[model samples]
Target: MLTKRIVPCLDVNDGRVVKGIQFVELRDAGDPVELAKVYDEQGADELVFLDISASHEGRKTMVEVVQHVAAELAIPFTVGGGINSVEDMKAILRAGADKVSLNTAAVLRPELVREGADYFGSQCIVVAIDAKYDEETNGWKVYTHGGRKLKDLDAVEWAKEVEALGAGEILLTSMDSDGEKKGFNLALTKAVSEAVTIPVIASGGAGNAVHFKDVFTEGKADAALAASIFHYKETSVEEVKSYLRKEEVHVR
Candidate 1:
């Protein structure tokens, strides 16, 4: 089996890392640059730095912040939030990001996904989907604008479309599970992962190493990402890897 990836996410609001439950009640975590360095040292396979408020606040991602964080990382870095055009993508990549993740922008204009892939190759484009279960829809619906606005799109279908649109990977975040620290939404993760040929990185609700193992095996996720647990030092990346290794899960 292919090695599974354990990633730590740094959600930035006004340039400071923060974590919240179900996308609200935000609490400060730490400085993004310092957190990035710590995760890199902890044997994280990759890191994600999100300008969590950029889209909602109507501004661009802090390029300087991304540059600073990227400078401290040897692992691959993905930057997202407020990227709306090819120029935006180019700016982030030039700032030293290995991949650019799109959520609101990609949903607003899916052509941007293809445009990004055409210009930078599919390997560099990751489409993030913020999904929450809707009883009205009887399925998960994609949310945008940092989980503030709802889109009339099914999560699974959106995942498939983005893959066809040339997204290299899908960063699937469950709004209902965001910062729950219970476990990943296995049903949602598995559904999206199976719907696309691209790698799926399951986000939100990661509580422990067993949670990571479950997401990889039962949820069929190629990668599992967490924020609060890692940020608060509830667990370390190396510790999780150690547990996964003992459980016979492939890891780097």
Candidate 2:
């Protein structure tokens, strides 16, 4: 069986790790390099470093910060935010990110997805979809610019398109559940997971270990990511893995 992964996300803004509710009202978590080392020591399967304000600020990802964090981590690392082109991906990769995630840029120019996959192989490219539940359309709508802009795109359809365009994985974040700490959006996660062949990393609303079990089993996410819970010591990676193991959910 493939073991489910537990990833701790570092939402960086102004060089400090931060977390917020529904993508606003940010609170400082800690230093990214320090947090990465802690997570690595705690046996986190992987770590995600997102310069949350890069895209909105119209700048590239913090290559130096990424390098610093990557240097401290022994496990796989994924970097996102303001990664706009193949050149951007190359720079981050050269700086030591195992993968580069694209959000607003991918929405604006999807050709970058194919171009990135071609240049660095699909495994190095991750397309992040920030989605909000739209009651009027009765579907999930894709958002970009850190959930500030809504695109006329369906989340599931976009997931399929990204996979076809050579994206190796999808990082699906539910804008509705973000920082709510209730649980993940199981319906949204399952829909996107079933719609695409590649792996799906479910983000948002993970408050406890049971939530990870639910996403891995019912939500069908290959991995579950959380920020505040882990950052604040509300839960530990080992505790989560132990809980999942007891629940008969395969985990690493």
Candidate 3:
């Protein structure tokens, strides 16, 4: 079986790492570069840096911040937020991200996905989907602009669409569950994972080690990403990996 990846996400704003519940009420986490080094040292499988406010502010990701964070890690890094074109992707990649995740930009112009995959390889392209459950839709709806805008797109269908458009992976974050820390939204994770063949990195609502196991086993996620837990020293990456190993979930 493929080893499930445990990723630490740095939700950065103005070059500082921050975390918030349901995508609001942001709190200071730490310096992005410092947090990146700590997670890398703790054996994180990968690191994701998101300039959470960039898209909403109409700008590109902080390349300087990305470069600093990238310098601290030996593991793969993914960057997202405010990437609007192939040139933007190039800049982020040049700054040292192993992959560039497109959220708002991709939704606005989905052909950008193919454009990026064609310029880089599919492996370098990840589409991030922020989803919130909608009883009116009878499923989850896609959110954009740092989870401030809701789109008509259905979360599961968007996953398949992006996969077909040549995105290498999906970063699925549940806005409803984001930062709640009770547990991941397993049902939503499972739905998106099963809908697409590409790897899915389930995000939001990761509370503890057992939450990781449940997401891997029942949610069928290829990897899981969390922020506040690791950011605040609530749990270390090594501890989570140890717990996963005990539960027979493969980890790297």
Candidate 4:
């Protein structure tokens, strides 16, 4: 059985790690390079570094930052934010990212998903979606540029489309649960996980080990990602893995 992954996310802005609620009201956490090294040594299955303001700021990802963080870790690393073209993806990959995650760029041009999969293979392409419930539509709506822009895209349908386009994985983040430290949006996670054949990573709203287990066993996610919880020493990756082992969920 494949072990469920526990990943620590570093949300970067202006060269510093930050956290926010529902993708707003940012709070500085620490340095990305230092945090990445700590998470790597703490037994994190993977590390995700997202330049939260890159797209909104109209700049490519922070290559120097990515390089600094990558140099500190031995585990697989994934980078996202402002990845609009194959060249951008290539740059990050060359900088030591095992995978490149696409958000605003992928939604803006769905063809990029297919093109990325063709160029780097599906396993290297991850589609990151930030979604929130729309009271007017009574369905989940996709948000872009770090949940700053609300798009007309339907979250559920977009998941299927990206999978069909050869995306290897889906990093589904719940805008409603993000930074709340309540729990994962299991309903949304399960919906997307069930709808796709590829692996789905549940992000946002992980308060404890239970939330991690819920995402893996109940939400059926292949991985669970958290920022504040891990960043603030609220929970450790090893503890979560130990708890999952007791729960009989395969974990590394």
Top model by TM-score, which number? 2
TM-score versus the correct structure, for each prediction: 0.90, 0.91, 0.91, 0.89
Model 1 CA lDDT for position 45? 94
Model 2, span 141-187: residue lDDT tens: 99988899989999999999999999999999999999899999999
Candidate 2 Cα deviation (angstroms), residue 154? 0.6
Misplaced by over 4 Å in model 2 are 19-29, 53-61
Prediction 2 global C-alpha lDDT: 0.88
Tens digits of lDDT, candidate 3, 1-252: 679999988777776666632222224235677667767788999988887664543234378887877776678999887788999899889988899999999999999999999989999999999999999978999998889999999999999999999999999999999979999999999999999999999999999999999999999999999988886778889999999999999887
In order, what is each prediction's RMSD in angstroms?
Answer: 4.1, 3.9, 4.0, 4.2
Candidate 1 Cα misplacement greater than 4 A, ranges? 19-29, 53-61
Question: What are the lDDT scores of the predictions, listed in order?
Answer: 0.87, 0.88, 0.88, 0.85
lDDT tens digits by residue: candidate 4, 1-252: 789999888877766777632222123236677677677777899988887664544244367677777787778988888788999888888887899999989998999999999999999999999999888977789999789999998898999999999899999999999989889999899988998899999999999999999999889999999888876677788788889899999987
- Sequence-dependent TM-score of model 3: 0.91
Query: Model 3 segments beyond 4 Å from truth?
Result: 19-29, 53-61
Error of 4 at 100 (Å): 0.9
Better of 3 and 4 by lDDT: 3
The per-residue C-alpha lDDT of model 2 at residue 251 equals: 78
Q: Which prediction has more favorable TM-score, 2 or 4?
A: 2
lDDT of 1: 0.87
- What is the Cα-based lDDT of residue 126 in candidate 2? 95
Per-residue lDDT for 1-252 in model 1, tens only? 689999888777776776642222223235677767777888999988787664533234467777887777678989887789999899889888899999999999999999999999999999999999999877999999889998999999999999999999999999998878889999999999888899999999988999999999999999998888876778889999999999999999
